[model samples]
Target: SGALTRVKTRFYHSGVLSHCVRVLSLSPSRLRGIWASAATLAHLTSSCCVGAEPGSRSEAFHRLFLPSVVDVLLSLAGQLMSRSEAPPLLRTVMDAVGWLLSAHPHLTAQVLSSAHYEQIQMSDDVTRSETHHTTSCLPEDFLSQLNDESALLLLNDAVAQLALSSDAAVGGASIRLMSDSQRSFDVSAGLDSLLEKDWRGRGFEQEVDQLIAMPRPFRLSRRRRRSHS
Candidate 1:
């Protein structure tokens, strides 16, 4: 029965793998459940990639499936950013992103690219309100002003938040992800500029400098086993 269950599980995962990208188009109410399940599946598959030897079935599957999974994950992350009540979901997605980046360093550039950043536009009325003082600008007006440069800044901010999170797993994973991505893309200048003004205030200036200066290779840390009381 256990062997049968494992076979069935593989079939089920393969069945849904092809539809992972399409799942991103579902309505938010529907997507909330689907994204969670899909993300879990993706994370499991990522482990296969890490463990498989070169030129093996697992490696092939990982190479083919991971890019689409990353695309969907990035889309989900962008969607989550627009909602105030989606922090839990956002954190889950970010965790998945970090995991994938650690397992596949090549994915770093795609995940952190501005092309993946969601473009949010403001209405004409909001744009016209720019004449108002910066202090008086409404939140919508402020969001409307986020161009490509500002969008990159926001992306960096999200990464920094996760890198500095209270959760040790999240913080470690995010730092690894950011460092790998920076090394792969050589984005130090741009990323440094984005964090310059607030890095000192945020207390990660030295850490960021070190990460950019010398990126460590990706390694999956073993989970600590819990002892029974």
Candidate 2:
């Protein structure tokens, strides 16, 4: 009776509960009650449409549930990238994405390439700050507004900044995340050089050395002060 009531309640309110449960699932083992609740919610969601005839009901279930599931999964990923650095949770989120990729490759790609995902990756503050400002335009539209040379220069600048970061944790994590995103999206252009072991070796120290070694340009001034007679 209790179990059926729980299932009925979860099934009826699957949308918000799914996300809540998914987030709760990321919690540590000491929170076993929360973990169990998440597991129960997952089971309820999975079983909600069972025994439905192969027709409109099943299709409707998919149409309603799939998007919500994708949203929750992507939200988990964003959380992992922005909020949490716990290795266990990170591994769990990675595994979830990997599994989702196998089952829904296109959807996974869409989620990964979403402007929201990019925003989360670009700045932790955007994720953390409630009042964070973001443009209404799509990431593609924003990028499209940049000319080819501007786009290339922007990309180069981002890469250089990440590669040359003075903080080891920040630089390493940013580069790894970028490389992972590129690999996931099947793009391997500029990342090859970045992924090299010696990349960080050519960071701030090297830039400083080059700057110090370069000679300053001398400019000849044309105007001369008139001599007093």
Candidate 3:
């Protein structure tokens, strides 16, 4: 029998966080990787967290996956915020981002307010209405929708009071957020109120299930779950 790979519990190894960044740069099919990584990231940042500084993990995430996917997620955020419904995959991404930002708070600015973020500018106001178009005219929606990175930054500055809400796993397809008694990758910020009900599509469940279906204990292994943190 092949040797089992030990999953790292305390800290991520050299390539883990960077790997997530690479996967995110691929097609939407790679969403599962993002989900798994997000969950692990959350778990690592929890009280039983990586042996790092008070909040350096935020920079780690910024340097790893945020740069690659922030453009897409932020742009996607505009469209989702305007509509009454959202794709499950997109919702998962937002959930994951909120998890990370809520955990670090500092990452919220590093990501949602970056110079690159300023350049993309996902919006619906008359100024950006030409290209992005106004998804909704509801003053609240327009107001809450951060076109220039203001929406999420409020959380970092304690200006925005985002209630810590969570959605039950959409499908039994993704990786569990927690590996032990602590928790998987939860940040407590409820981003669900913004997006409507979940779509029927699978979250990160199927991949995990597929893996689980394979050889039981042998297929699973452990290590210090390396990270960019």
Residue lDDT tens for model 3, 11-124: 234445444444444543544335445433333332222223324455654465344444444444333333333344334445544544443443445554554333323332
lDDT of each: 0.45, 0.39, 0.33
- Model 2, residue 145: distance off in Å is 32
Candidate 1 accuracy as lDDT: 0.45
What TM-score fits each model? Answer: 0.45, 0.35, 0.32
Best by TM-score: 1
Write candidate 1's Cα lDDT for 2-95 as tens digits.
5654553464356554464566545668866465565455455443334333334555555666677677766665665555544555555556
| Model 1 alpha-carbon drift over 4 Å, by segment | 1-13, 19-62, 118-198, 201-229
Q: Candidate 2 residues 1-229, lDDT tens each?
A: 5576566445545555445445544644434444334333443443442322324444544465554655554454454453343234433443443343333333433544455445554554323121111111113233334433433333343355454443454454334333322111222344444545444464444443332232322111112112221
Which parts of model 2 are misplaced by more than 4 Å? 1-55, 61-64, 80-85, 123-229
Best candidate, lDDT-wise?
1
TM-score for candidate 2, please give it.
0.35
Error of 3 at 205 (Å): 40
Q: Could you arrange the candidates by TM-score from highest to lowest?
A: 1, 2, 3
Itemize residue pairs with steric clashes in candidate 2. none
How does candidate 3 fare on TM-score? 0.32
Q: Candidate order by lDDT, highest to lowest?
A: 1, 2, 3
